[model samples]
Target: MAAVPMDDPGRTPSSYWAATAAAGPDIPPFDGSERADIAVIGAGYTGLSAALYLAERGFSVLVLDANEPGWGASGRNNGQVVAALKHEPHEIEERFGKERGGELIRTIGEGPDLVFGLIERYGMPCDARRSGILTAAHSAASLADLQRRVDVWARRGAPLRLMSRSELESQSGTAFYPGGCIDPRGGAINPLGYARGLAAAVLQQGGHIRRQAHVRSIRRAASGWQVMLDSGSVMASRVIVGTNGYTDDLWPGLKRTFLPARTPQIVSRPLRDNLRKSILPVGQIMSDTRYLTVGVRMHADGRLHLGGGGGTAGADRPALYEQLPREARRLFPQLGDIEWEFRWSGFMAMTPDRYPRLFELAPDIAASLGYSGRGICTATIMGRELARWAAGEAAIDELVLPASSFRTLPYYALRGPIVEGTVLFHSLRGRLKTPG
Candidate 1:
């Protein structure tokens, strides 16, 4: 087999989250042959959480990563802890049937709580907040959608409330939105810091996490599964693959299951206290109903962070960098002449159905990926579920989300134009929406 090239450990991503978050301790890469009861690939939130939980149960666990923990999407997202899936509730119920749909709803509804609970339990200093998440309506059509969302989630026992335009103006400090709703279960956090904290917790529990140890291949061995690295290998009873958007050819036909999307974010120099107060006054994380999905959050250091506009990785088109700042000034004119400080992008795996996928590839091998853009909370949920499944504490079918047989996307090579055209259409639709 050809050796798999790993991400550069010496390269640092340009991100406001990474620039300010505390650094984690040094972790060495795999050197020689090793044995473990369980091995996890991709040391992001899912792998680290699985390692921590499995180690707490006295199982020998090892985690391997192409880069350090959070160096991928886990470290580069907008940091919103959204609890709901990308699809509407009615759509989910119609697709999965009432009983199973309710199960899925309850599971996703508890995602944010699980994230915050872990932080508190481990005393992780990740700038986590449970203030809430507000989905604002930019037009009358969007407001109608929010109405349906509030009613649907309320029926499922969610603490959701529909706010008036006046309430939105007061809370969000802008009149651009007609109205919206707040999900008390949703919030925000420092995603990079959270990933590092999880790694620390895993180490404290005696789990081994090896940075720069990229898996080149996985095949059955006398021990159950053999994971091949560049300079060494590991024998394990079970393996969990959580590579997400960075998934490669480690497992045959695995990376074709989803489309990798590049979402860019822009940060401003610290806004004046008055300007910060007038925008996102209550400190709630906020996003609009545009198809392109505009979102903004206030950083702990008083800088404003905003994300939108999907494009290719490392493109850094001048047009793309101007998109967020232009929208920000339009919404909050107080943000005049914004001095942009940071511009970076993260890759999220977008499934055709926009739902996360879990697979039991073989009896001893399992994988989870494609959380859409809700990884801050859903990744944690998947990690814990993976650990439980590996430990025989829960069966795959009994898990919150259904496990699906591996399905590859048709015409996967044409994803570039397809994704770009789809995003362009969404942008046009967003521009057409004006409050009635």
Candidate 2:
């Protein structure tokens, strides 16, 4: 793993979302002992959503975070609300078996509905748009894979359409993609605003969120669990850890279970009306099929947001983001020398299988993390599943993704060099236009 310093809770990154989103709710840091039915660590989307649902179910929920809600990847993400996992529907069924896999597919496919439904229900101030999401194919192999995806989803009555080269070029305003597909269920949101909105909704539902409450350890107690903080302790019957990529030694070896990959993003100054009209005119978010996926989207205000997959460590430097502008120019050559105004990075936990996990760390302690690059929608739905399990409405085995023992990724410590090499290999392959 990387030797990066922990994020400073008091300082949110100067990303575009932080600058444009509304102010987060005024939350005080932990100051005194607290007790609740459930204690949640990390107030990202998963924790906040779980706390909100648990609070709604009349459980006393206490959420503690090193920083304010949405300060981590939850706030910094590109905000594309994709509804499916990395695998195709058939691949999922082949892996998890017919029954469980079918259930998982159905639940995951409804992820966008859960996200958009929450926004509508809470009347969140986030710029929520359900315009759609496009997956552009960078190669012929990728295009064929997309065709398979479209066929499977179409059989299931999903609102997905495979696009020809011309259609994709027209919609994305770029001739870079050979083909693509659009999932109308997916869309975009102001991620920071959405996280803040979730925090507000949790508070409104009587959930307690304490910011700057760095949890030092979790120990067993006669009552249940004791979450020791920098200045206070929280005792609850159960503990939920939703730290994702910011995960540390909070739980023994939890950080080793997944690889942490940094994703860097750059935002351009709002484009002129003519340029804006020429690019992504349909208001859809897009990501290509490259191994190092490049994500692009248009802000409601017309700023061009582009992100690239960073290596395993030390991805916070400005120099690491220089390629983004080049990529933007490659996609939209007409926008020559556009001034990029914001550059920032966040970590996403990558599991071996690229699927998020629900792990049973202890008798009453549950942890969920490793969203790969699909945190917005997956985390929201996972939080509800966690809430159901915590509330005893469903057993862990009956959850959508059953809780399982942690299987630490082998060679986890060497991830830095490993990821760098993999990135290099993929980059070379992509340059050569080799099959994926």
lDDT of 1 by residue, 316-431 (tens): 45765667887888788877786889988767888888889999988889899998787877788889989999998988877777898799998567767666777878777778
- The alpha-carbon RMSD values of the candidates against the true structure, listed in the order shown, are 2.6, 1.6
User: TM-score per candidate, in order?
Assistant: 0.95, 0.97
User: What is the per-residue lDDT of model 2 for residues 1-436, given as tens digits with 9 covering 90 to 100?
Assistant: 3544265335789999999898988898899999999999999999999999999999999999998899889988898899888888999899888899989999999998999999999989889999999999888988999999999998888989999989999999999888899999999998999999999999999999999898989999988999998887999999999999988888888888888777788998989999998999999999988777888998878899998654546556666787778788888998998888898888888887888899988888888898888899889988998899889898778889766677887798888887677767877777666322
lDDT of 1 at 218: 98
> Which residue ranges in model 1 land beyond 4 Å of their true spot?
1-10, 313-318, 434-436
- Whole-model alpha-carbon lDDT for candidate 2: 0.87
- Using lDDT as the measure, the top candidate is 2
The C-alpha lDDT values of all candidates are: 0.84, 0.87
Error of 2 at 47 (Å): 0.3
Candidate 2 residue spans exceeding 4 A from truth: 5-10, 434-436
Output candidate 2 Cα RMSD. Answer: 1.6
> What's the TM for model 2?
0.97
